[model samples]
Target: MNGGPRLFSILRQGPYLIASIHTALDDSQLVRFQQDLVERIGSDRARGVVIDVAALDVLDSFASRTLRDIGEMARLRGAVTVIVGIQPDVAFAMVELGMDTGRVVTALDLEEGLAELDTYAAAPPAPRR
Candidate 1:
């Protein structure tokens, strides 16, 4: 995580913590990526995460599961995880593989995903007495 163009970039915009995944995510790198994310979230308490997957082309079962796990883990840490840039064919194939992406918010592109995260960030926090 210290070099190699950064598997993911952690950006802090106001109250939102965005993690943009710029490299090709695979089984070999997914675990390290997740560990990095966990550390970031633990430190920042980010309200939302935007995973930019535009650079990825082929996603196997392990990658898909990693994504799903990322989403769930982010949620457990109180951050919303949104996956962006998933191509149509890849999405279709993921569905065929029964990858439960239902928990992960998805966007066609980074801009849209960031916008969605903005909305989530802007929403009023739950009432706390």
Candidate 2:
């Protein structure tokens, strides 16, 4: 993707990739966003993907589904995905609209999201003695 105006920003934070959406995205930007995320994940090989959507006030069905899809794709690429920063209104709207995020995990904020992702990335607990 061109380095033009980006709808979102992706930063490599340790073993996790944090993608924060800064604005309301149109359909085209959404597509570009997906492509960019895929490229970033592929190149970085991050252990987890944390998407911070605190700035986004509106979470439409399309956007929600796209995020879910992205999370699934990230997992396929060997990285767990955690979506954080969901607004109260957006959460209510999503529930009222019956928009499901499938298996995508969610957290209250970036810190919590990263914590959850770490759990996913960490090695499993040892067997019982």
Candidate 3:
């Protein structure tokens, strides 16, 4: 397997990786996406990730959970994951479904998401306990 998704792409932009989902993806593809994303973050030494799902019309519970998991995994790699471009309808549906994003940050668009990454990058690291 190429460890890549056909329905979406993970493009590198400096210290961030942008996962742009232009269309819906099946469960298997989502898994591949999760794996590929984490791997790329390490291989590319990315400081952050932005998952853009604006083009998606529907975001189901499983997909939402998978996204949350990806965010958590990325964080473990010392990278911040921000999800952007969630459509209004899909955002409502996620709220109605009671889906939570956990520690993942969200923004309205790519520019905002990148700004979030910049802010996080500029912030000092959490002091060790």
Candidate 4:
């Protein structure tokens, strides 16, 4: 692990899961991390994911798109994705850029985000076909 606050941390809170991203999430890194997350959730039986983004100083188009894609991908795998610690300025920038963040659940801080994950996990699962 890189000593610089770690790029990400995968934590399991009962049936809920969190991927606390502690650095700027670029495209290549996001892809690899998402794959790792999928695998982790597969083994851990987690129902939701909280992506912590407090340490990121910037959110560009590529990063924003990657986040959206990750969220969608996680959802396809039956895991809800929440974006946490989005700075106000960064959030504004994303909105200004026309990035549709509506699909992403947002939280002001990591703890709040994790709490949301707990709620999602506790909720009833969707009915299967």
Candidate 5:
């Protein structure tokens, strides 16, 4: 279980679920968030997910992996995942670490994330590889 109250909020907007992380979460909390998010994606029948990590000053490897896994899990449930609001420092560190972004897409902010989803929706579907 998470160590305390939820550290983030997930709200569904239309076909997208937005998860805003306003603070750093412990390992357990991060895992819980990932699980809860994936479950919510299925339950809500979301077509896309936006994870905003603007408030987090650091992005450790574990967190990066968890984000990637969340995207992959959501994809398996027929949803796209976009990560928005990555601070410049965190983005630099992620680049320096050669972090693999995997299935998640990145955007400048929530607006752009939602726009990305909109574009995805308007585009023709891709054939599965």
Candidate 6:
């Protein structure tokens, strides 16, 4: 169980699920969030997931890695994860600290995040070679 306030909130939006994280997540909260996220993705059959981290005051190395890990785990369960709402300072800090969320797409805000998912959904399947 998370010792602090809930680390994240998951909301279902059409075929996509939006997970918005609260500020200042410790290691335990991150683990719990991942487990709960996996359960939600499977139960909801989410085609895409948007992680809104706009609320966080800062994005440290641990949180950055955890977000990427969560995205990868969701991907394994058949969801394309997009991380959105990274503050300007956080982005600068992430670069300075050498932190990267590998392979996780991102957007400027929630609206753009939803649009990204919708665009992907609207695309026709690639024709077989």
Please report the candidate that would top lDDT against the real structure: 3
TM-score of each: 0.81, 0.90, 0.94, 0.82, 0.93, 0.89
Q: Write the per-residue lDDT of candidate 5 for residues 24-101, one digit (tens) a residue.
A: 988898998998999999899999999999999998999999999999998889899999999999989999999867
Per-residue lDDT over 34-103 for candidate 6, one digit per residue giving the tens place of the 0 to 100 score: 8888789999999999999999879888888988998899878878889999999999989998998899
Higher-scoring candidate on lDDT, 5 or 6: 5
Which segments of model 6 are wrong by more than 4 Å? 1-5, 124-129
Clashes of each: 0, 0, 0, 0, 0, 0
**TM-score of the candidate numbered 4?**
0.82
Model 3's C-alpha root-mean-square deviation from the true structure amounts to 2.2
Better of 2 and 6 by TM-score: 2
lDDT winner, 1 or 5 = 5
lDDT of 1 by residue, 30-92 (tens): 888888877787788787888777777767788878888988988888888888888777778
| Candidate 4 clash pair list | none
How are the candidates ranked when ordered by lDDT, highest leading? 3, 5, 2, 6, 4, 1
Per-residue CA lDDT of model 4 for 10-30, tens digit only, reads 888777677877777667777
The segments of candidate 3 whose C-alpha lies over 4 angstroms from its true place after superposition are 1-5
Error of 5 at 77 (Å): 0.5
Tens-place lDDT per residue, model 2, 37-129, is 878998997889998889999999889989998998897787889999999999999999999779999999998998898787677844565
Tens-place lDDT digits, model 3, residues 1-129: 356546888999999999998788889988988999999999999999999999899998889999999999998899999999998999898899898787899999999999999999999999877
The 0-to-1 C-alpha lDDT of every candidate, in the order given, reads 0.78, 0.88, 0.92, 0.79, 0.91, 0.87
Residue 55 of model 1, lDDT score: 73
Better of 4 and 5 by TM-score: 5
Better of 1 and 6 by lDDT: 6
lDDT of 1: 0.78
